[model samples]
Target: MDKRNQSTVTEFLLLGFGDLHNFKILVFTLFMTVHIMALTSNVLVIVLVGVTQSLHSPMYFFLSQLSLCEIVFTSNIVPTMLWLILVGHGKVSVAQCLYQFYFLGAPVIAQCLLLAAMSFDRHVAICRPLHYVTIMTFTNQLQMVTSCWFVGFTLTFFIYIFLRKLRFCDLNTINHFFCDVAPLLRLSCSSTTSVELTTAMVSFLVILSPFIFIVATYISIIHTILKIPSTSGRHKAFSTCSSHLIIVCTYYGTLSSIYIVPPRDNSINMNKGLSVLYTLVTPLFNPLIYCLRNQDIRNAVYKYIQSFRRRKVVL
Candidate 1:
């Protein structure tokens, strides 16, 4: 790979499930259905939170932000993958690839922070019920959500800045579904030691730290719940935080598997499968898990439906 040959590279091929080309139609249909379901469910949560005044608490506020992040996060990558599947063309320009990875990484980090925010809200509510309102005021919630978005963008910007300087040379084919940092780094002909180290530290800050905080919060929550004298009281306490726990576990479980575990030669397919689970399947199920488990959300949805029905009858 000489300098002359390296200078000609301007595009990269995304080898998205190339082995599954025989099942392209099936894969396209499956991903399309998942994308629609994810969008509808997340948007429904947002709309419900906005209209249902009773649901306007610090927890629901963070939940709505999480939904918004999921919508943007999935939108950044899924559509392009679906289109490429349909067209059988995986070519993406250097600029397009970089932007895609940048946007996707931002939302991914935002979601991690949003989840941490949600856990902190739960901790305040469960551990310090008397001061929960004072601690988690509307202004504080707004600032926390805004900070998450800001940090998300800032961290990813540095990542993309380093990535942009890497020389791709002639090895421009990305062996994954999207322009993820790992795949892109793999394709870079230049040394990625600094970029890799930076990414690792960012991952710890964005993903690992939040995850640890959430765990600590839940541990305190559990300790608090155990002190309650009555069985029904403990049940009631657990019920409220259960949905958040489910979502947190589902998200971090798959995500940790990807980042924590070392990649290997034989596990590329396995890694892609895990990516699909986290990126595609997790977002689709998040709203459903929350809505189904939450009685308040269910009641709000029911009331909304009844109001719509009454209007239809009047018209």
Candidate 2:
């Protein structure tokens, strides 16, 4: 790895998805729609959780936090992507690129923590109904949320510093949409030893570790669900776990494909598709997953709508 050519390389060319003029507007519209839908749904979740006091329990408290993270996550990437597509500046400053990578990476890693904690919260609620209140106290819940942020942001920020030192000598085009760690690292002309190592460390700690925990916890949950003598009780337990399971599968599955595997020439399309899964699709699904089977959320949504209607009529 020679620093001569790399150090001279300043900005990155984000070769965005493809070089096709035909579907440009349609593709932009679709991505924008996802961004808007995600924001709208996540915002609705926040408001619903706030206004519906019954949802103020530890589970929904964590949910509210998840929604907040989602907002931060999508805003980091989608707006920039929209701007680039609209204004035609595909190359971003190195500093700006690193910063975007940090923010984007932080939320994704943080989501794993939040998701795992939520699973634990659910486990306690279902398995240990009697001691759930004492164990998952407000303080404990707060601690969990704090831990999620601390680990997420700290891991990504440190990694960002290593990534910033790399000199991009190759094609500056950042393949895919937002600045991802893999594609960015591939362009580095300098030794990527530290950058790659730090990335792997964060991936293991933030992504893989929590994914395993969530899976194990869900296994226990499934056993419990199966043990219920009454079919209705079993069904109810499965119902509660359904949304979380789907989200876990979607978020972790796509994310793991990107970070866990080495970059392959054949898998570029797969990476692009998976990036869309976690970035655009997951956020949109979280709100719906939360309220879909939840009677309380559904009721609150209706109540909120009805109140809005009454206010409009009065106005």
By TM-score, the best candidate is 1
> Which stretches of model 1 miss by more than 4 angstroms?
1-7, 19-22
Model 2, 187-268: lDDT tens digits are: 7777899988888787888888888898888888888878899999888888877877888888777777788877788888
How well does candidate 1 score on lDDT at residue 265? Answer: 86
Candidate 2, lDDT over the whole model: 0.83
Least accurate 10 contiguous residues by lDDT in model 1: 1-10
Total backbone clashes of model 1? 0
Q: Write the per-residue lDDT of candidate 1 for residues 66-90, one digit (tens) a residue.
A: 9999988888888887877777658
Return the TM-score for candidate 1, rounded to 2 decimals.
0.96
Off by over 4 Å in 2: 1-7, 87-89
